[model samples]
Target: MRLGGRRKSTNIQDMRGSGSRNRGGFGRPTRRVRLPSGGRTMRSSGGGIGGIVLLVILFFVLRSCGIDPLQILAGGGAGSGFEQMLPQSQRQNPTPRATPRTDAQTEFVSRVLAETEDVWNGIFQANGRQYPEPVLVLFSSQVRSACGFASAASGPFYCPGDKKLYIDLNFFDELEQRFNAGGDFAQAYVIAHEVGHHIQNVIGVLPRFNQMRQRMSQAESNAMSIRVELQADCFAGIWGYYTEQKGLLSRGDLEEALNAATQIGDDTIQRRTQGYVVPESFNHGTSAQRREWFARGFESGKLEACDTFNNDV
Candidate 1:
């Protein structure tokens, strides 16, 4: 990706070292699918909302390019789910303790956010809607969000309650080191995926899903969450499409992003962590599902092509 002269987003809040550490661990139902507690549904692509590689072709492609995808997959840390716990009564309203600071990684994230802002802002305007840029909150190991408290272990997420993105820069380090899914585009995919969640919130998809999820059974909710998560992946792909159009992508950028998607797929994570599969418990789609949706968006670059709800995800 060509990020040399890109403008970084100013809508950032730096709160590193400003709060107590989160002794909190991953919530129940794994660390990947903690829905918001207050029914503030977050939704996009068509309905709602990775780390490494699973394909042989990807393995060869990456290897031929001098990047061993498997080596990155061997690292331990791997969780890509956002948290949505604690009732509204227990939620804390966090105040920023520091202003934006442009370190190397943060600047990369900020510029990616800016790019998304450019694409979505234009897309929204074209659709006769206004795009309200979301804030990206950078924290230490732990941080408080309107949705709930999160640890870097649980990965980055967007909270609909506050309309802001919460992330620990360390998570990106983990994405590459621990998850073996290193690359600028991979990191961008992670950010774009979270931004996709914000898009759902903006388009009223999440709000509607939140209301409906209250009555949904555990299995039903899980099924619905898969759609939501896949949609976000597609939305990220849409951003990728636009980014490529601007001549930002290099030779292996798309594969790197797809590699990250497969690395963090629900099935792959389960296989690595538990040595078994639980199809019924999957909230995020499988590895192939994730790669396909992202490619679909990248190929079509159309919002309508990302309708994960009405079609097979």
Candidate 2:
């Protein structure tokens, strides 16, 4: 977590405060919905599976017309259901306004991204392959991606379609306040996890999973998703391992990441939100599972050891 004097990544797009406004409606009548603090009141196309599908179709139609679909879904709350359908992203919102503190947070994210680039580049070269670095898009309120339109509530995510990571930095605040997963390393874990997805995309794992999920039942697909997410957690742990080896990790850095993995586990989130845990519906693994997989990667630092698909998660 001690990133003092570290390099910041240049492959970052600062789209903060430049979000486009929602104008025309999709198909149905647009309704007004209140966003979190500093968020704009935008129009929604309605909620439900049918409504989301319709909005997606509309999104394509608008894209063909050279319009940004993010404008359409910004106020619609349609991104929630489609999160798992695509690659994983973080979702949470805090005040949208920029501040000096936010600048520091942005700097921290850039440095962490640089660290991942350094670690992964070396790993790929050692394996006789070149690493193609991914760009990270920093946005507030809403942003349009090749995967689809997303709101800040949709969280940080990596889109394989675009090979870029999208994040609303405010989610870091929510990570600390709502999930109780604070600290710089915890935030680094969040970025590293998404970068882990980028690794999956690079290694063809994500495409294979996407193809296989298409032929799976909902339950079966959810199971695959758990493996995919756990693998990403393991990849993040791999990054952590190298950081520790480089003497960059502080005393409690690993604990911060483990606590974060615990807090965001599907079981823990479901238990807190619904007062119960549904193992069948769990897609991101349990608290114990996440921590274990991360620990496994951190301990071994072997890509083979991080394989959650063939081995028991």
Candidate 3:
């Protein structure tokens, strides 16, 4: 986490105060079409875990109203699943505001992103492929992404639809205070994990997963999601490996990242949220799995070592 003197990434969009004025409004203009060629929506299949849950609720609601679930999903209406499930009062299309002051936290995020860019670029080059850097969008409260509208409550996510990473800075506070996964390295791990998604997109892993998930059952898809998330966690560790090679990591930095991986495990979150565990609904992997994969990547620093798909993750 010794980030001093590290270069900051220029691929950043600051949209802190330029969010929506209404609960469901977009502060900025967004594309009404499907995601770009390389972009997919969210990570989970069937619109992601939240999306699936909402879809079920919505289906039941529509059915209760004597409406067809298929029609709503295919309604092409303003209140479609894509538009209705956002946090209330999320607005977009606000006037561009002045860039916020650069603080230590912001600088740290940028540096970490830059490091990922460097590490991934090298890795891709070694594989005879060029790396396309993804944009990182910093927002507050709520933001509209090519994937969908999301609030801080949604946590950090990568939008393949936009080839960008979306993060609400407040989530860092939540990670530290609520999740008790505080540390600069922990924060870096979060960013690197999303960047790992970008790597998956570049390598065509996400697209295939998205397609396969469409045909998968909820339990099956959630299992697939755990693999996807764990792979990203491993990728984050890969980045950590290179960072350590560069002598940028101090003692206990890796521990911070590992603790973060454990704290945010699906089991831990589920236990905290509902006071019970539901292994079937777990999208992200268990704490042990996450920690194990991360350690695997850091120890080996090999892409082949990070394959959570072909092997039991």
Q: Which prediction has the highest lDDT against the true structure?
A: 2
Deviation in Å, model 1, residue 216 alpha carbon: 1.2
Candidate 2 local distance difference test against the native: 0.68
Tens digits of per-residue lDDT, candidate 1, 1-313, equal: 9988986676677676644322121011111222222421111223111001112223234223432111000011111342221223422333332334326676788789878977776676444456788887777667777766665545677777877777877666667864578899999998898888887677655655665555656677677677777878998999998888878899999999999888878787777666778898777778899999999889877777676765667
State each model's C-alpha RMSD to the native: 14.2, 14.9, 11.8
Once superposed on the true structure, which residue ranges of model 1 sit more than 4 Å away at CA? 19-102
lDDT of 1 at 253: 98
lDDT of 2 at 21: 28
Give the range where candidate 3 is weakest over 10 consecutive residues by summed lDDT. 71-80
* Residue-level lDDT tens digits of model 2 in 182-251: 9999999888988888877776656545544445566766666677778789888888888887778998
Look at candidate 1 and tell me the lDDT of residue 189: 94
For each candidate, give its TM-score against the true structure.
0.75, 0.77, 0.74
In candidate 3, what are the lDDT values of residues 32-140, reduced to their tens digit? Answer: 2222323211111112223223433433343234321111001111110111222234323223333353355667788898788777766654444557888877887
lDDT of 1 at 109: 82
